[model samples]
Target: MNHRHLGRSGLMVSEIAYGNWLTHGSQVEKEAALACVRAALEEGITTFDTADVYAATRAEEVLGEALAGERRAGLEICTKVYWPTGPGPNDRGLSRKHVFESIHGSLRRLRTDYVDLYQAHRYDYATPLEETMLAFADLVRQGKALYVGVSEWRAEQIEAAAPLARELKIPFVSNQPQYSMLWRVIEDQVIPASERAGLGQIVWSPIAQGVLTGKYRTGQPLPVGSRAAHEDGARFIAKFLTDDLLGRVQQLQPIAQEAGLTMAQLAIAWVLQNRSVSAAIVGATRPEQVRENVKAAGVKLDDGLMRRIDEVLGEAVVRDPARTASPEKRP
Candidate 1:
């Protein structure tokens, strides 16, 4: 796998990262999940991204077990904070208490002394930004986290935090946003702001929750055992379930064929076309899915193919910068 520097940081991550978002503990069986992790390792995927909130934190444990025998130095494990992990008030957000406490839990579960990257799952409006940055700074100094990042944070929020991160000497290196052919919300503002702040994007949902994969066909019932068929997974994917979107997605079939790539690989390569994107995170329920998507790692789409994608997805794309929003309040 090709590696890229995460933002301006010296850290190098696999261009195709394995992420356990909805798959590990809840969607797929343990054996399948382990096989998928193994597949990623075999494919040279060095980075693994997860969150404290995913599958009630069981995903991290599953990933930890899968990577137990590997050389830790060769891996980049990333987990996030700022989601409610318990009933208590201190269980969530990017407050100093939660940030510190969450890192310990994450480390214990991941079976690693330190994560390569510790990200804020979402910007915490309730907590002071300084408190969050200071907590991250402390984690870096304490050797519990090597780098810091944020996910789905707006441009203004990133601009607000960059100076403080610099002041605190925290290595804020990445922004994990949802960027896909159908979702260009990050392109207009987040990318520009992050480029200025020296942050690269580790984008999730690059296939639009599997929409761009063309598996969800127009006028067809939800595919059996697909993400949309699963209750927990359906929530994030419902927005792209409409007939109109599926029709637009189908228009990419010719583009994928001309490029000699699968719809999934084409969608992934589309996101990596942006120089600001350091890596594209992919999750899999089966090992073969892991093998297929990684082909996009070093592949580049030509200008004509990219234009065809834009022409096919025109008007169906969501590009408004204002739509790159965070939660109004802590969940």
Candidate 2:
């Protein structure tokens, strides 16, 4: 519930950011989502992270509608632009046309003049970087966006955007990458790159999309109507949720037990232990989940606990998984 500066940018955001990924309109209904958002605000969470592709853009509209009931100045809103929205060739990417069109769509959906942060959801290999950055820069220039950021970008890609933003006088702020006990690729590349560029880091799914939550045990079926059970990308995750992964998760049970916290809480606290991590985005289907997640913010782990975590899952960390035959962007 505490506030933290987002990367090197001047804008301050809640350390615990509410993100709507697969939860909107699917696992969570509008009433429940609104309750969660309200609970987040009451818990001191001020930033909300959403994306253009989340639930096919319905998530932003849902979040916007939920937040609209409250005062507009009460929250720091963030939404990403990228991903194919329609069949047209120009439906996606960071092109000027897409950026302009996307924001208007997001604005109309969110019912706001501007979002606190507007992020390029991913690296647009086809769109010229200049066109993309300048378009984002113009958003800030016009006060339609308070800050610009990128998500799940490679080290070199972010490094390139930083200088370009500097020359254009764009206030590029942070990177939102998937960071959790199960995944540490960002540490191998993105962390050092971000530090060098003075960009703050905000990580998503610090619980590894609920893997670290310790809710699914070995041989137990995926919970009925869970996000992983419903979403398409989640089907890929289902394959990885094996007895082996569950066994590893169980290993950390003792570590979290010693800290008097749940595995999910311990995992999220671990992500925040790094000074470079400005915030960790956590989402929930209900208000109780919000309360459960917020407890991690109060549980400070020691070096011994960290080493124990590393020992339990050391084999999972790879130097560069992106170099493999299958390059996974974000999960």
Check candidate 2 and list the clashing pairs: 7-200
What's the lDDT for all of these models?
A: 0.93, 0.82
**Candidate 2 has what TM-score?**
0.94
For each candidate, C-alpha RMSD in Å? 1.0, 2.6
Looking at model 2, how many pairs of residues clash? 1
Candidate 1 residues 1-331, lDDT tens each?
9999999999999999999999999999999999999999999999999998999999999999999999999999999998899999899898899999899999999999999999999999999999999999999999999999999999999999999999998899999999998889998889999999999999999998888888898777889999999999899899888888899889889889999999999999989989999999999999999999999988989998898888888888999998885898744
Cα TM-score of candidate 1: 0.98
Estimate, for each residue in 1-331, the C-alpha lDDT of model 2 and write its tens digit.
6778888777888778889887876668889998998888888888899987888888988998888877778888999988888788788888999999999899888989999889988898777899998899888999999888988888888899989988999788899887777777788778888888878888997887787877778877778766567665486356347777778888889888889998778988998898888889998988998978887774578898798888888776434637311223332
